[model samples]
Structure formats: structure tokens, C-alpha cells
Target: MTSYFNDVAVWQPHDLAYFKRLKAYGSRGVVVKSSQGGYGGTPYINSVGKLQVINAKRAGLKVALYHYGTFNSLRYGQADPASEAKLMANTAKAWGLGKDTLMVLDAEDSSLRTKASADAALFFNELKRQGFHSFDIYGPGSWFWAGRLKIGTSYKLGGWPASYGSSSSGVSGAKAWQYTDNWKGLGVDGSLDYGGQYTTKSAEPEQKPEPKLTKQNVDDYYYTYNPKRVIVKRTIYQHKNNQLGSQANRGRKLKPGTAIDIASVHFSSDKVPVPYFKLANGTYITANRWFVNNAYYELSNLKTIKVIKPTYLYRDLHRTKVVKRSGFKSNKWPKGTLFDVKKVIHWQGGFVLKLTNGFYCTAYKKYVKKIK
Candidate 1:
């Protein structure tokens, strides 16, 4: 069977935004540092580290913890694996980590002289005895090297090897691969979990429900800067540009009342005889239909204002388009009609307003008073 890896983003205190910004990316799981050794008995979890673990759970990602272990008499001549394991277990227990959660002991210390693999077994044995059910061993490429830390398969321990820019972890039955330390501009080790110790079972942020388009007009968000501003009216069967001339696939099908974004307008070919809107993703949505330019929507906040006097409210400030919903080509609002203004500005030789409900008309600033 061919082995595959599942993505799981990891972060350390130094390389760090922590895990709070995880929603911005699609990492399915995260492994955070629980604590570290070499500082004596009572290991302290940095506030940032604690927050990363907690936030990973809130973001619906499977969370795990790892600890950087120390050298022992068998490895480098100093640092006890037994002492380190006990401290690691005690720290996690106090932090309230469930025994079911995967814990990892980083066994990649390079200064070991001999018997490193035996020391690793001792560490794992201690963790298992301390009640960590799904713990694993994490080491660099050197641990599996001939004379360095020779990991034993008899222990039946799962491995997460730090193999940077390489195609393989070089360790048999490895659970995950620490593929790289720097990915997507983050200064942290990244891994691909192989489902031995961790699984990508959670709701990812990218799979959102598509909006329904039921009428000739509907309002939905389009990306301007943050997918929250710059509303535009989109119509059905609008062609996406890059898909336009491709033999492999035709342009994307756009349904009537479907809301789409315009990255920018393009008229690449005059011979084509139409304009197209560049989508936020660099693709294109066509403006082949004339009515597309007239989709009803608002680009700003809606504000209520008091109409001081009865005035003719044209659908357009220039009286070009009338609000047919009012049953009048040109409607009139009596004194004291409360209207929400989407846009208040100066028009041709007069003041005009765009209504929140998608009516464009002109009204004098003095004749209409802003409520707040």
C-alpha cells in the first residue's frame, strides 16, 4: 500500500503567530508545545503556548502536544530520560490534558554518545506507565542514522520524523512527517499526519454553503477588501473569462440572481464586443448581459433620515429609472416618510440619495434631515 500524509500545521514559541490565526488557513490539525525540559523540575507552559492549544480546539482542529526531552546517562552522559518523562507527564496532567490526546516526546538530541535508542524506550515506557495512551516519538533524520539514536521497532512506537525537503521520513511505520520548518511564511515545522496517532476529523472553514439566488435580484457579499464590502448586481449565465476559450472546460455557469464579485472590469478584445468582470480569485465573470449593470444592492451602511417635505422620489436621481414597486414611474413621499439612505451625495446641480432598499433618487439635504 502506498503511504500518504495528512496536513497538520505546528507552531513553536519562537516561529510564531501561535494558533489563533488558524482560521485564516486550512490546517486540519495542530500540535503545540506543552512544555520543555532542561529547566529543572517544575516545567512552565508559556502563556502563548497554552493559548495556542486552547484556540486550536476552538477552531475545531484536532489538537495535540509535544515536549522537547533532555539527554540521559545513556544518551549524552547527563540528563535523565526518566526524570524528563516524569516532568513532562506531570506538566501535562496539571494542564489537564486527556490521556486520549496524542502526546509526543521529541528524541532528536544530537549530542548523544551511545544507547540513545534504549533511552528513548525508557522514555516511552515511562509515558505509557504514566497513562499516555497515544503518545509517539518525534525525532530528526539523524535518530534513524546508523551510529546515532537507533530507534527500535520492537517497541512498536509510532514516529513523527523531521525530514526537511525530503520525500521520505526514512523510518518504518512512521505516523507523520515533519516535512518542513518553513511553509507559507511561518517559521515553524509543518507535518503530514499519516493517521496512526492523529486524524483530520473536523469542520474546515473553507466549505461554506453556497448562497441561493431565487429572483432577478438578491444581495450577497462580494470581496472588495475582506469579502464584506463593494456590493454589485450579478445576473445569470455570465461567462468567466479564462474559461472562455479553453477547450477543456467552458465558462462557469452563472445563475440568475447569483451574486458575484468583480476584481476589475476588462475589455481585452474589442472584437469580442462585450465587457467582463475579473473575479476576486483572478478568474472572470462576464458582463455580456446589459441588465447585469443594474443589479440592486447597497455599497455602504444604511442610515435613516426624516423627510421634511413631500417630494417626488424618482427611481433614479436623474429620473432615468423609476421605482416600479411603488406602482408609479415617479413616486412621491409625503411629509414625515422615514427613509433609509444608502448613499447621500451631491448630484447634477442638486443633492441625491440612494435608498437602502435599492432605489436611487435625489433629495435636498435641507428638505431631508438625517436622524443621527
Candidate 2:
């Protein structure tokens, strides 16, 4: 009788209840795909990896993570393996994986076969340098048999090779042998654990101490939240505090150019001069100067503006040239003439409103009455 553990990638079904059922069916542990090749110069993190890890733990299964290696591909091979390893390690740490978690490198790509050992050595070495110790390399048994990926003698890392049809994995010194693609009709890859990483439990990483809170300095701000409306200018995460670190939650992606209503601003002593915005929904987002624009927030809030007093339209913010023939019957907008506000620009000591016709006018309450 062969004891088997399950391993999954994006292709596998990830229902939490299903994992509970796998545990009930006598499976002891599982390996989950955590990342892939670098995307846009960073590791391509699996969207469901965190969810899978959580569910597996809830199901009482001893769990670990693996990265689908592509550093050997023609497109990504030019990159240093250390960079990819660091990105992967950082991502895993961000996901709350423990330092002792078994991190496996799935180096099955034929393009990697020739240099698998050297590159895997470098990749695992960087992971080790980053405080991750337990590691393994998984691939076809023939790759090891042909001397394509000899495990480094200096490192405690082991191999996990797949050799389906046989009772034993042909590769010598393999930590585990993947024996079947479908175990007990579960429709997932099954590996026979050899009493190593797959069976050993990993401890969670230590949590950092929370930082002290303080009122945001006025000098640290460029644009103040006037109407409680904010617009995201760059993708950012929601954090529990103003201090930025791995604790920033990546589950919710505050995308660029998104206009959102904020409840208020939170001040913190994060060493960096940025304040945090408390959203209407009670989530905290960084008010990083480079990541948000309050100008758009003001613009989107003003649906229309009414002329409370006579005003002349200027071609630009300079307010120097007011044409004699304005679009209306006169050069000035008459009192009570209503128009939609298209843009808002902060000018000297005040804000300016732009009309749909590319004309600018003072946004002062005396000149224009804002209509929500």
C-alpha cells in the first residue's frame, strides 16, 4: 500500500469543501502552486494561491508552496535567477508563508533541462539568503537520471521527480515520488511522501510590532481633502496603518484613476510623510503623494455650477485674455446661467473650474454656485 499526498496548480479545483473532503479521504497534505515567471519585471503571483493556502490549513492539511520556474525560457532566461528567486520569496512572505515552508521549484520546462542544476542552485541559494530554508526541485525523473539537475551537496534541498507507472521514483535521493495524476478518482496529482517536507509541518513567520500613530504633518500634504472625494492615480493596497510594509493587504486592488469617496484622513508616524485615507467603507489606503490626485476628486464631485455673478471666460489659468465675443450673446456669463463643470484646477489661493467648451472661470462661491 502506497501513501500519497496531493499537489495542485491553477488547473486544479480549489473549493475549500473539496479540500476538506480530500483530508477526510485519508490524504495528509498538499502542495500548491504559488507563483510563475516574472510579469512586468515582477513575479507573477497566483491569484488563488493565498486562498488555497488558507483553505488547506482550515482543512487540517499540512501545506507548502511551489513556483513554476521559467528562468530557463528564451524570454526570461536572460534575467538573473537571483532576481526571480527574491521576487518569489518576497511574494511568499507577503502571503504569510512561514520561513520553514517547503518552497518547491517546478523546473519541468524542456528549455530548462540543460541548465536546471546551476540555475536551480542559484534560485534556491537566493531563497536561502532570504531566510527560506526548506526547498525542493520537482521535474521528470529522466532529467535527474541524465545528470541535468544534480542536487547541490552543500544545500539540504532535495528532488521530487515524477515517474508514473512504477512503484518507485527512478531518481536517486528524491524527497518524494509523484506516482499518479488521479488518486482515488480525485482528479489531482498525487505524490508518495518519503517522510520529508510534504509531511513535516511549517511554523508561521513572526509578526512585526505595530508602529506608533501620530497626526499627519500639514507640511507633508500637497492636496488637502476638501470634499472627502479621492481618486487613485496608481495601483495600491489597503493597509491597517500608515506604515507601509508586507502587511499591506493585496486582496483588494485600488486601481489607478479610480474615484472613491473617503470618510476622513488618518495620521500615522510611519517615518514616511504620507497620510492614510479612511475610505467610506472603513478601509485604509495610503495617501501617498505619488499615488493619488485630489484634483480629480474635486472635479468629479461638481456636477454643475451656476453663475451667481457676472464672470468672463478666460482661455487659460493665466486669466489674461478674455475674448470680446463669447459663445453666449455677451462676453460675460450672465447671473443664473447654469453650466456643467468639466474640470477643476487649483490656482493661486483658490480653485478654477473648466467648462465643456475649453473655457476657464473662477470657482469661488461668489462667482459660481456649485450644484451637486
- The prediction achieving the highest TM-score against the true structure is 2
Worst 10 residues of 1 by lDDT: 221-230
The predictions' CA RMSDs to the true structure, in order, are 20.1, 22.3
Model 2: per-residue lDDT, tens digit, 1-372? 435678987777677998898888878888988887654354777788788888988898988888887775344554457777777787788889878888888888755648678888878888899998888888888888988766545666667898999968887777688989998888898888875468644333234343443345543343444435556666677765444455645346676657767678665653644456776665677665556665332445787888888988888788887946736587987899888778887665346788887888876555677776
Instruction: Please identify model 2 stretches exceeding 4 Å from their true place.
Output: 1-3, 39-43, 73-79, 202-372
Count of clashes in candidate 2:
0
Model 1 lDDT tens row, 60-128: 667677777665665334346666777767766776667666777777655443556777767767777
Per-model TM against the reference: 0.46, 0.51
Instruction: Give every collision pair in model 2.
Output: none
Q: Show the lowest summed lDDT stretch of 10 residues, model 2.
A: 202-211
| Top-scoring candidate (lDDT) | 2
After superposing candidate 1, which stretches have Cα over 4 Å from the reference? 1-24, 38-44, 75-79, 147-155, 201-372
